[model samples]
Target chain A: MAFFAAVNNWLKHFAYELQGEFLLALKTIAAVFRRPFYLPEILEQMHIIGVGSLYLVILTGIFAGQGFALAFSVELADFGAKNYLGRIMAIAIIRELGPVLTGLMVAARVAAGITAEIGSMKSSNQLDAMVAFGIDPIKKLAVPRLIALIIMLPVLTIICDFISLAGSWVIAKYIAHVTTTVYLSAVRDRLIFGNLFIGLLKPVVFSFIIAFISCYKGFTSGGGTKGVGRATTESVVISSITILVVNFFITKIVFSQLKGWL
Target chain B: MIELRHIHFSYTDKPILKDVSFVVEDNESLVIMGPSGSGKSTILRLILGLEQPQQGELIIDGDNICTMKEKNKRKLRKKIGMVFQAGALFDSLSVGENVGYYLLEHTNMTLKNVSEKVVQMLGFVGLDAEEIIDTLPDELSGGMRRRVAIGRALLSTNPMIMLYDEPTTGLDPKATENVLNLIMKLHQEKTIASIMVTHEIIDALRVANRFIVIWAGEIAFDGTLEQLRSSDDPRVKEFLRPFLSSFTEVVQKRFVEGIATENNSASL
Candidate 1:
């Protein structure tokens, strides 16, 4: 009886949190269309998320691409199919690995920053101060962040995809003994519109998941420093996991719909 | 004027304020005193429209805030300025930006003019505007932050009321005195009713013309300073005991001196 009661309470709490998150997302979307848009705040966020994450994304793409290419080269050597390394690398990196890995990395870094900054403000009563001053925190804080993420995440993923392809090229030429012309031709042939579409789409969804979840956690955080710390950790963990989980669903849905195109 | 009628508030299943009622008139300085968690600060929150009571009518200058639309409520909030605990200055903004935030957002004031106004307000609050304008809240001393917050609250042109929630909490004695002095200065300089919530009775008595003590979510006592001193309520006595015991001589002497001064003025 006690176990059932606990489970029931947990379910109720989860549902309540879900409802809050959904409402926040709706409000943020509505706020985007509302007048008095905070252009400076949006530009600042774009700079922070886009220019700030450029180096990290580039590094991740390089290493991930190189690692995958090295493994593929060795495996294809055994199968006497080393010539197809570029095609396989292009398919895996662009459609499957690029968007998901970039989302996870960006989530881990950006979500924590967003949560900590907002959570600290909350603990310090600045949020209440904003409310006291009659400024809508969602419009002032959440909307700018959501807008920045929406614009920057796909851009970052594209850069990550390009860098990863370059990294794979280097490995394929040096290690797989594949000719550069053949590898480039193979990659160009396989990099279809469908692959690019799925890759870009995943980041857009991931951006929403990261921004809304992190902001919600920050806004709801309490108990001072410890609470802010807990919220930050939770934001990163939840955002990363959500990105991974949602990536699967998006892929499943898109693939089912666009099977002929793929 | 601000009125809270039969205000009942609860954050959860347990109630924080039960049937709390009070009225604060224009330019009236009110000191709300209570033990911690007795809903003293909650009253200020209720008035600021930061939190709505589960059941009550909060009328600010005739309109029932309980039923006011959120947009109208926001407009109503312009007449009320709040100095949250520890100043609650925006951490990311510099002191000047924090003080001029309202003007920048609400008014069509030019940046140059807003900067001048912020400087003037900061000076009025006894802060050296040039020295601190560029400084962030985290760099300032506790007292300085509170002063910046007070300046921010008072920056608007037509503020009718000011709410200070534990404004002097977590400050040194000198800092507390500085903040209390600033509050008294603002009260004298502006036609604004001030509601201050504090645990310090001496500080409360120094600034407030009237006192309301909340004990366990109810008003235990509400009257002038004289009535508060002469009250026989056990709860009020218990709450005031520690502070009054130590400062009885000082309080009595101050009252006697005040009466002597009044008598002297009457003779003149």
Candidate 2:
């Protein structure tokens, strides 16, 4: 009887948590539609999540694109396939590197900040105070940041793709001494809008995942300072791992279906 | 208008409040006194609906709070104002912002009206209206922060009940008097029901119409202040013995010192 009771309680708690997540999602949607658009809050979040991430994303993009180009050039030269350097770099960054790098950078920078701020508010009763005052904290706090991330992450990924390709182009032309004409011709021949569109898609999904997970963790944090710390760690770890996992599944499914069309 | 019937609350495995019951009437001041860790604050939390009692009913103004839904709980909470032990003001917001938070969230008042009300509350709390209302919580003195917390609680004007937990703790004599006077004045003028938890026996006696003393997780004494003062119970006498002894010492020492000094002066 006790074992069955414990199992029943576990099921109950699981259902409760599921309901909470559903409510949160509904609240997020409602908040986006209800209030007058807060341009200032969106702009602030953009500056924090997008503009501040530029340096790290750019640095990673340069190294990743250049490294892939150099390594592939060496291997392909042995088979007389060195001319494919531009194509490889363009495809690699557009289809995978751009989204993955940008997602990881955001998981580190933007998601961590969101968790810390919301966690502090949770521990201090500010969130409760907000509820007591008839303000939906999910609307006031979470939705603005989520919407901002959705808008900003894809834009940042596009910027990263452009910069990474530029880095590869410079390395191919200047150091490897491949002609500028050949590099440009190779990229123009191989790159497609589908590649760019697929790259852009991941960041939007990543942003939503990151925002929802971090906000949920922070909002549910208990046990004060230790709880806040645990939430922050969980936000970063869970977001990064989820992004990687989601990226793989999305890539396989999207590319496989596209291949069928081809 | 708050009533608790046979409340039993615990944290983890230890009981904090067992068989605790009390009723607070409208416009009446109820002071809950007890030693440290006697669960005085837990009672306040239960009344605020921040915590649910394990095995009893909490009815506030004819509604059962324990069985209420979350939305209704929030509605009930709005009718209540609580001054936490640490004031618990939003550290990120300014004094004015903190006080005006509820008004901005709940009402359709214009910013101008909110600003006017903020100024009025600050003035009522004896805080300088012209001073920088944007000063952060860390910038304010302890007493000032407590006053701002009180002001924030007063923002929702005409809450059915006000609950204060250790409101006068960590204050100098003058500041304590200020807080005590504020509580009395708010009670007298607004006719708001108040439940204040404090260890300051004198302050409680000064403002309380009814006193409820808890000992070891039970309601040990419940009566008017006159009844409490005249009670012959050993626990009551033991608690009040320090104050009574101090009073007698002052009187006896003054009499003896006066006679000795006069005799010495005459002999000289």
Candidate 3:
């Protein structure tokens, strides 16, 4: 009975937070078209979320692609199918690894930053001040970040996909001793327009997940600076987990559609 | 005008304001005095519509805030401004930008016009706009930050009613005097309805035409300074005891010195 009661309470709390997040997402999406566009603020967040996370995205992309190429070469060699290295690497990286890694990196960087900044403003009564002064913090704060993430995450993920393939090409040519022409042709063969389309699409969903989770965490934080720190940690952890969970379902749908395309 | 009728507010089941009622008419200032954590700030929060009371009618400028929608409440909020305990200036903005924040956001004023208004408001607060325009909130001194916050709210909305949450607490005497003088100046020049929450007895006596003292989440006394002086309430007396003794100490010495001065003047 005690175990059941504990589980019930935890479920109830989770449901409450989830409901709150849904409403916040709806409000943020609606606010995107409302007046007071805050162009300067949106541009500022673009620089922070898109430009600031570039180094991490590049680093993750190249390393993951290189590692995958090394592992794939050994397996393909086993079957005397070394010629298929580029296609296999391309399918895996663009269809899954590239977007997931980019999403995870942005979650760690941008989401944490958003949570800490807004959390502190909330703790210190600045958000209340904005409320008191007839300014909506959601429109002023969260909407700009949302717009930035939605616009930038796709761009970031595309770059990541390109860089990852570049890494695969390098590894195929230098490490696996495959010719450049073969590597290029194989990668080109493996890509359908649908794969690239889905690769680009995943980051838009991921960006929304990261922005929504971080903003919600920030707005609800309390207990001053310690609370802000806790919110930052939670935003990063929750955004990362939610992106991965969502990635699984999204990949399933995209694969089904791609099979129809085939 | 602002009125709170039987306001009831609590935090996580701990009552902070219970059946508290007060009114401040247009062109009037009400100063609230209370011990720490006695719901003085909660009253301001209710009126600001930042926190709705569990039970009450918060009337402001002819509307009930308790029933207002969040969107409507934000519109209602433009008529009010507040200065917080720690200034609460937007840390990301420069001083001039903070002062003109809402104006820039909501109004169609050109950049030059907004800059001019920012400079004028900073001047009203006795600050040099050119000197501090580029300075961040963290870069300013405590007194300067408080002044900048006041400038921000006052110039941003041109609010009809203002609320101050212990603006003078933890300040040196000179700085405290400057803030008090500024409050009086605004009262004189703008005829703005205002509520100030402070435990500073001298400030309450000086600034308020009417005062309310809260004790244990209820109003223990509400009246003029003279009425407060003659109150038989035990809680009010206990709260005023330290200040009363110090006041008496000064008066007693002054009375003795008056006799000596009178004799010296007579001999001369």
Q: What part of the reference interface contacts, as a 0 to 1 fraction, does candidate 1 reproduce?
A: 0.83
lDDT, candidate 3, B1-268, per-residue tens: 8888999999988999999988889989999998999999989888888887899899988899999999899888888989988889989989988999888888889999999999999999988889999899999888888889899889977889989999998888888888888888988899898899999877776576788999989999999766777899999998888799764554455457767989999999
TM per prediction: 0.98, 0.83, 0.94
Better of 1 and 2 by DockQ: 1
Evaluate model 2: give its lDDT.
Answer: 0.83
Cα deviation at A184, candidate 2, in Å, is 3.9
DockQ of each: 0.75, 0.37, 0.77
Q: Which model is ahead, 1 or 3, in terms of lDDT?
A: 1
Off by over 4 Å in 3: B247-268
- In model 3, pairs of residues that clash are none
lDDT of 1 by residue, B1-268 (tens): 9999999999989899999988999999999999999999989888988888999899999999889888998899889989998899998999999999989988889999999999999989998999999999999999999999999988853579999999888899999999999999889888689999999888888888899999999999999877888899999999988987755765687699889989999999
Among these predicted structures, which one has the highest lDDT?
1
TM-score of 2: 0.83
Tens-place lDDT digits, model 2, residues A120-161: 887877776566565678877888899889998998898888
Ranking by TM-score: 1, 3, 2
Q: After superposing candidate 2 on the true structure, give the runs of residues whose Cα lies further than 4 Å from its correct spot.
A: A1-43, A188-194, B10-15, B35-37, B199-202, B215-217, B229-268
Spell out the clash pairs found in candidate 1: none
True-structure Cα RMSD, model 1:
1.4
